[model samples]
Target chain A: MNAIVTVLRKEVRDTLRDRRAVLSSLAGALFGPALFAVFMNFTVERTIDEGEAAIEIPVVNAADAPNLVGYLGQHLIEAKEAAFDSREELRASVRRGETEVGLVIDKQFGTALGEGKAARVWIVADRANASAQTAVARVRGALRSYSSLVGVLRLQLRGVDPGVARPLAILNDDVSTPSGRSVLLLGAFTYFLLFACFLGGLHVAVDSTAGERERGSLEPLLTLPVSRGALVAGKFAATAFFMAVALIIGIAAFAVAVDYLPLAEVSMDADLGLVECAMAFAVLVPIAVLGAGLLNAVTAFTKSFKEAQSYSGIAMLLPTLPILLIILNPMQPTISMMLVPSLSQHLLITSIVKAESIDPLYFAVSATSTVAIGALFGLLAVWRYRSEKLLV
Target chain B: MIEAEGLTKRFGDVVAMDDVSFRADDGRVTGLVGPNGAGKSTTLRVLCTVIKADSGRARVDGVDVAARPLDVRRQIGALPHLSGLYPNLSARENIAYYAEMQGMPRREAGRATRTVIDRLGIGDLSDRRAKGFSHGQSIRVALARALVHRPQTVILDEPTNGLDVVATRALRDVILDLRRDGRCVLFSSHVMQEVAMLCDELLIISEGRVAISGTPDEILRETGCGDLEDAFVAAISSERESK
Candidate 1:
């Protein structure tokens, strides 16, 4: 449509108008990927060096927990120990970025075990750092083994057989899918893409309608003999094109980031090629349609420039839902559940990372559903244009 | 020419326009004057095809507005109390956009845009952004956009809501020129004096219904006012007193 081209031009022109929009979008998308590359590269080398050396970690002292401290030094050729007075003080240290971790033992540890009860210790550290958390798990494992050994020695000292005391010893092994090894990787990439979509189309839609309203130029456009449908189509098409451009930048960010995920101990395939990259972009088309259509609909119904932005806040939240959900839980990707907006693309992306074959039917349905929803919203927006109350 | 029969618009049980009807002839500026919340903009928007009436038959040049909005739209132009330029685009781009929207060819839009830019005396600033322009400049741009397609009728909803004398007079001249070209022009304004000075015919609306419709001379003689503004105040008060 001629209107669609005009709308597209307006959308593109608006993007070219703002410097901050481009920088901010690329920042959200690029920060994670670029950071991941630098982090993984630095961490991998540092971890390899640490893997070859005996490392020192601080332990908070609690009275009568001698055996627990001894257990942590077993696998090392050398041990250098530091002391903290209290667990809370150690947590404060971690919070203040003074140390990566602080190991703490409770005061009641020996007393509880003497009375044959469970005793616990805390690993105080910044949860945001994955390396610190992994190290804390290793420290916990060493302490647990030491505690059980002491319990068995105590049972033998009381003249009961150690074998009889250990009758119900349980061993836990993790059973999880190899296909979803990079679920968090998928989420991180998805968040980047959502950020891309938002920043990409945002300027275009705002400038096209609300910007027009704010500057008092909406009258001339509406007064012309063109149908409101044509006007909306023009705006919607334009906004979507910009969204797609942002998406491309986002996908590039993901590609860059995924190249550097440690994928540690998972044997996950590092096999994403150019074809898969192109397919990932293709799946984004429907979402592009939805973003553009929804933006126009919100901006048009708003009375002023400020009001339109408040309405578009709903847009800012919608794309991030899938990302937030996956990041919180370990998600199993399925093709059948494609109705969840950005999650569908997330599934396809995990497949790319693990080198699993992507289902063609699933991607086809995903693009279809996104475009269909876009069309539904487009019709609602067009109906609003005919509304007397809305324009005035 | 424009005609309406039993035009009524309702929001819930409250009727804004209840069985109101009036007609206006071609080649003159017909003023629709009322205070705020008087349904003046509503009438103009309905005529511009920006909105629809709940129940009524309204037509521009015998084209049913509801039934053939696109057809009726092709015949009418309006500036509804606001400028409608795309902010990012230059003034020429904004005008060219509307002209294109009206199905004008590129060369035709170019010619018309240049002519209106010259005629409205905004030629020097046609390449500037509309967003940062002065109110008067924006109004001139809006008027240029409206007249660029040369439609058969023009309806403006309070076009002079915010303008200085220079812009207001320029708008009045543009309306007069439209009348001289034999195109029917309808505009609503709260400033009764400007309406009285510029409009040859008048429609006084109160509570969405046309309370009085006549020429400026006829309304003045009928209401016994020295001018059209006093005639409007008298007619509006008279309509309220009767109710």
Candidate 2:
């Protein structure tokens, strides 16, 4: 135990003095939060701006339907006189993306309305253009309302009640809360936190194993009167320490970055506060042990520092796989899912951000399972160290 | 003291050490002189507990290397073929790290580190990080690190592989000092002149086997050679012809 502590202290002190390692860890921790802030801010601002802005549609024959155009104007749909003379031209313009949607009134529209016959109108739009769908919907809605108003007036003229014309009323009920709406975006927050934790220990893990061997220190180091298990344990502990630090920093940075996001503008509440951050840190921190263990185990197989670095780069991506799968096909938290390390932490973090009550049983299972697997990897590293092949 | 009897280690089909036997005693410098690829390093590695011999008994101060490697490691200090130091750590810290690993208390390790640094005459270079150290400076720091624990036996593999005239002389003085202090010093060298100058007992190895081992004069007289260098060639050639 004393030997373990000695090796741990030496490794940690040596890593701290390495400027490149320290800087890389710091950079990784900050990179995720800064990117999340910028992306969230852009998305929130665009959604809010698009919600309030008026939509414009070019009308092929605006003069023929002054009254109809006037009604659309009241619904925040502006009608501009189009340069084109025919409906074909309007269709081409909409298809070319020069206009989101175009209005084309039939040549016989005025006569048909005078004779009390049905009049024709066309809304030219490309349904596949996602950005243009909003304008198309707005224009279609205004036209329908105008048609209903005229029909209601016609019913009154005939001394029939307007209510008799409509037999059904439809309403929409949405159940998602403000915080619940933000959980999808905050899922990324947990991913970044986990990634930062892994990154924090990468240098130390590679340095202690492959770097030590490459520098010719492993032989001398193994010659010391300490058990290989104790040495591995010490190195593992130091790596875990750095990872935990990075996790803390990531949680704090995300907490601050969340405040700058305009989630409220989109009716989404970012519940990432001091308490939530603390909870998240607690939930995600155990994976650092797993991260350190895994990294050390993988790098131990490499022959040189450069080879270990490249191999570890790929190894670090393992944690993110479960997160990506969960995001694409979300599942409710279950006992079996808690058995998986990164997936369990992700579910817990998502629940925390959504402001849901966490089950202590789930936390216990998740934390215990994660640490158990981490210890297994730690033991694997020790086994590798004990092998004579390690010196080769 | 270090002893190996009928030690043999093989890497797959290539035998690295074959029936190698020798004794390095306290209060004397024993040189394992061989050309590159000979078993000098392999023998040292086995004694230092870095690797195990396949088919023989090796002991450091009568502690079996295979049965009790940790105990054997405690009895010896080794400088490997490469002067491996943590580039980011100062020379003092490097030495102290080894001292602590040897089970010294923190304060005692620090004191021991200081003593070794001063004794090696490397106090001026102790505080500097090892990244910028020249080969000579690195060797001195590595030597200090190895001696910080003051084990009964010290094993160095090619300690003077690359050193200037001044550095080599300084290293010779340190080796002599270890002998005077009654510590067993076992070092390997490929250079015949270096082995002739420093070795109180010499073991000549060729092709993974001991060709001849004795005092310089004894080897010269036995081989009917006028000097140690010619005796080394004659012993190696005779061993090869017999094989």
Candidate 3:
């Protein structure tokens, strides 16, 4: 234990002294949450602002479509970016990214609406791409609701009373925790954690091995009374400490980002209080351990500093797989799943995002297994230390 | 005390060492001098128990290097040909790290680190990272680390390979000091002059075998040469010509 402490302390002190190491750690911490917050703010603004804006369409004849397209145009801006006469050019323009959305109001649009016959309205878009798709969907929905209202009003204007046009009415009474919430806003926080873990400890691990060897300092280390195992343990501990510090900063940034970022005004389902944020931080520690272990072991095995760094980058890629999977599927956290290191924690992380309780058994398994896996990394680092090939 | 009895090592068909044998008393410095590729480092590595010998047995402090490998390692300080120093650590830290590994107390290890660095005139450089140190400074730190715990025997492979004039002389003085302290100092070098100047006894290895092992005077007399280099030339000339 004393040996390990001595080794760990040396590493910690060295890391604290290197300016580049600390700066990179802080950069890794802030980068993710800041980017995610910006993305979230943009998403909400796009939805609300676009919903209130005008829908663009080309009315072929002003008199022809008095009913649908003509009526809808009154409520939206009509941007005449393309001519309706050239079908091929319109299609090419959409394909070549000339426009996000396009609408064509046919010659018979007003006549068909007035006579209550079949009316054709064409919607043209360049690969909807979520934002454009949402705008199109909202615009189409508004037109449909307005048409029905106009139809009922026409009946009232003819002979019947306004209330008699519609005999029955439906009302939505939703007792939501937060009304009109976006799920992505909650998910951005988890993504931020994943980003911070894999990138934080990479440089230190690289510098400790290949950089040392190339500079001719590694030989002196091996000659020391310190056992190779102790050396590895010390190195692994230092890197893990750096990663943990980075992760803590990351979790804090995310918590603060979630709280202070304009998220209060936007509706969200999951709310992270002080206690919940603390739990999330507790979960991040084991993940940082797992990350630090793999990074150190892999870095030790590599031939040079650059090689170790490149390999560490590849190792970093593995953790993101679980995060990406969760983003695509968004499942509840399951502690029983132990196929990946800290995957069970990701499950807990996902639960935290959805405002669900963390599974205790899964949490225990994740914590135990991640710690075990981290020890295995230390064992591997020791094994590397014992090897003449790795030492060279 | 160190003893090697017909120690042999081979990689498949290529023999690195063949029935090599020698002894080093507990209170003397024994030098191993040989040309490049004469199995000097390989023999030292086997003696250090860093690698296994093929057949014959050897011992460091009466423990078999082959059979009881870790026991031999526990009693020996080996400075390999290649410097394995960690660049991030200072001279003191490097020495302290090794001392701590050898089971020296933290306080004692710290003291040993200071003593050696100051002895080698690297006291001012002790706190600086080893990355920028000259080859001489690096070797000084390595030597300090090697003796930090004072193992039963010291095995150095090409210790002064890259030393400048001043550093080389300083190293010779340290080797002499270690001998005065009565520690077994076994060093391998390519330079016969260094072996002649420093070693009280010499073991000249050639063609993966000890061509000569005796005092400098005996080698000079037997080979009919005035100096150790001439004796080496007189002994290995035929072999070199044949190759």
The candidate that achieves the highest TM-score relative to the unseen native structure: 2
**Candidate 3's residue-wise lDDT over A33-134, tens digit each?**
888768777866766677676656433343454455445666674545435555455656667766555666666776776676656666666555555676
Candidate 2's displacement at residue A191, Å, is 1.7
Best by lDDT: 2
> Per lDDT, what order, best first?
2, 1, 3
Residue A245 lDDT in candidate 3? 78
Q: lDDT tens string, model 1, B139-160?
A: 7888788878788888887888
Candidate 1, lDDT over the whole model: 0.75
TM-score of 3: 0.85
Lowest lDDT sum, 10 consecutive residues, model 1 chain B, at B80-89
| Residue-level lDDT tens digits of model 2 in A249-347 | 988899888887878889999777889888998898889989989998998888999999999999999989999999999889999999899999999
Model 2: residue A340 alpha-carbon error in angstroms: 0.7
Model 3 misplacement above 4 A: A53-135, A156-192, A207-228, A329-335, A387-392, B11-13, B66-75, B237-243
DockQ of 3: 0.40
Candidate lDDT (C-alpha), each? 0.75, 0.91, 0.74
lDDT of 1 by residue, A51-107 (tens): 555556677764457666666667441223446677777778888877776677677
Provide the TM-score, chain A, model 2: 0.94
In model 3, the fraction of reference contacts reproduced equals 0.38
lDDT at position B90, candidate 1: 89
Write the number of the candidate with greater lDDT, choosing between 1 and 2.
Answer: 2
